[model samples]
Target: MRRLAALVSLLLLPLLLPTPAQAAATPLQVYGAWHCGDDACIWGNVRSTTDFDAKNHWLIDRGDGRPSVNVVVLSFVHPVKLLHKTTDAQTLDGVPRGMTADIVNYFAGRGIRVMLSIGGITYTTAWNSALAENAAQFGRNAAEVAQRLGVGIEIDYEENSKPDLVGLQAFIDAYRSVLPYDPSGANPAARLTIDLAAGDRWLIDIGRKATADWLRTDTPVLDYANAMVPARQPSSSDAIANWQEHLDGKPTYSPPIPPLAPAKFTGAFYIAEGNKVRAECADFTASLQKSTGSFVQTAAPKGAGLTPGMLGYMFWAAERPSTKGVTTTPPNSCEGGVGGGATAYAIPIPMPALRQS
Candidate 1:
């Protein structure tokens, strides 16, 4: 009987190897650290006068042989004013006052694909006005900046209370029109993405409306939705479940929005403040590693709805907070530091490969 049982277990192992429902066939790429860490983030909090210190803010490759997150969201292009935009520009406050193009190229030269995030939490009104006033121009401007700087675009629209679906879609259409996606990777190495609320409870309306069109079928304009972090204390379960339900909508949806394929989503979270690292964030990492259980990675589509898994994780930041003290010295402060945050998520959570694309 023991011998027979052993034989049966061995036979079942092969059957368990493939997760058919997974979004991608390859093991899901770990897309960690959607950083805007510390003063270097420039877009979030304005800090010291030096641009050199901001560039080396994050210490990604520590020479410890641990797998660190490969990508960092260079962060923030707040308050879009493209109506009179120019290729050479500076931040409103002039904190990151220097040649923006050179700063962008510095990271790219080191093999890190930097994505320029447009719209922060405070710039909701600006986003509304920018998209509503001139979506095409806004798109062109975004594309121009992305092209010239050789970076990608991340629309961090946090208008959960009253999201402008029409205007948002218009922006997507306009941006994609100018910077269209090509399947063969022939297009310039530019990535486009957006942020949605953590779950359906808060942004339920969007989950229903967007599933039918914006996210489900428009792969050329956007990559996947980064379900922004700072939900309930332990929001991973709800976040993952919301994405799961997104793939298969709830019964109560009015007009019943189309289900979003898992291939079109990624979970995001914070690595600072009340969001506990060991207890809270690590569980989120485990769930993401599991591909939210019901989800999987795939590349069969290769078109409008290409590749799979929850597209990957986006951490709140990659820099140690100012409260953590200037972890690194001057000159290197731009891309250095991790004082109290040494064992933070960087090496624990799987990081994306140096995203050169």
Candidate 2:
């Protein structure tokens, strides 16, 4: 009799569950911050791993309510000045291959994932040389640095007009081959990802590589791609449309671009919008759960994409790279630079989706 009663309860479980409209709103997906400490720090002092104080809110909580980001991608490990030759040497805040575990751990201890982002717009010359000549060394150097510092690696190389696809592959392969992931290792949560042009038009070549090749492989070398801010901010609806256009090719191209599944793209936004024309983004605080699926090309509720509902969110920066000391929409807590939302922290996973995993 008890077994029959239990079986009846199991069968009725679906009825007991909340319907789509009745469910609670889901948590935001992919809450991340780009920590640009590699010298955009003149207005804001350079961030040293060993350093500490009240202003290090980017590294830790300061009793305020700013959401602690789940992921922190340390900015810019640019190539050395010798652009003609391939060199393994890279620099962070003018320190060749300099990185420290203290900063990595300061956030890691708080359950955040840390990564090292290589190449920014300013380091264009170095990118041309490193990828053109020292591809393997550059990749190895980046991976090795992240390995040493106990963090992941992010490729932000922006030379899209003529990207070195062959060299890039070599770089990725080298980085992956050397730094095998072991959850128990010092940098167990380490991941290898890349920065993509915000939209399809600018980094045409690189975007092609991402859609036609990188994302389609069974064992993709990259974990995912971050859609950096496009020239203009499109609304959340427009943003999703742009992502769809990239993944599922629009009709205008001479040869319609091949489409990739929606799962690989993570739309990035500028967190500290002030006077600039904002990307047509939805409210920064808009809940992923509350969004509908008009843009994502799926029947699932908004934000659900690929393996994890839409790879998740990445802020242009943790500290505004150029907007030092400028007051942002949400006034900052840290000094010298604009620290938009560092008062608290959050996990990157989608709340409702985590249950499936």
- In order, what lDDT does every prediction score? 0.53, 0.55
Cα error, candidate 2, residue 126 (Å):
1.4
Candidate 1 least-lDDT 10 residues: 333-342
Candidate 1 wrong stretches, greater than 4 Å: 1-26, 40-59, 62-67, 86-99, 185-189, 217-220, 232-236, 275-308, 320-357
Compose the digit string of candidate 2's lDDT tens values, residues 220-263: 55666787877644566766666656565544765445554445
Displacement of residue 159 (Cα, Å) in model 1 is 1.7
- Angstrom error of the Cα, residue 20, model 2: value is 12
Displacement of the residue 231 alpha carbon in candidate 2, Å? 2.3
TM-score against native, each model: 0.68, 0.70
How many steric clashes between backbone atoms does each model show?
21, 16
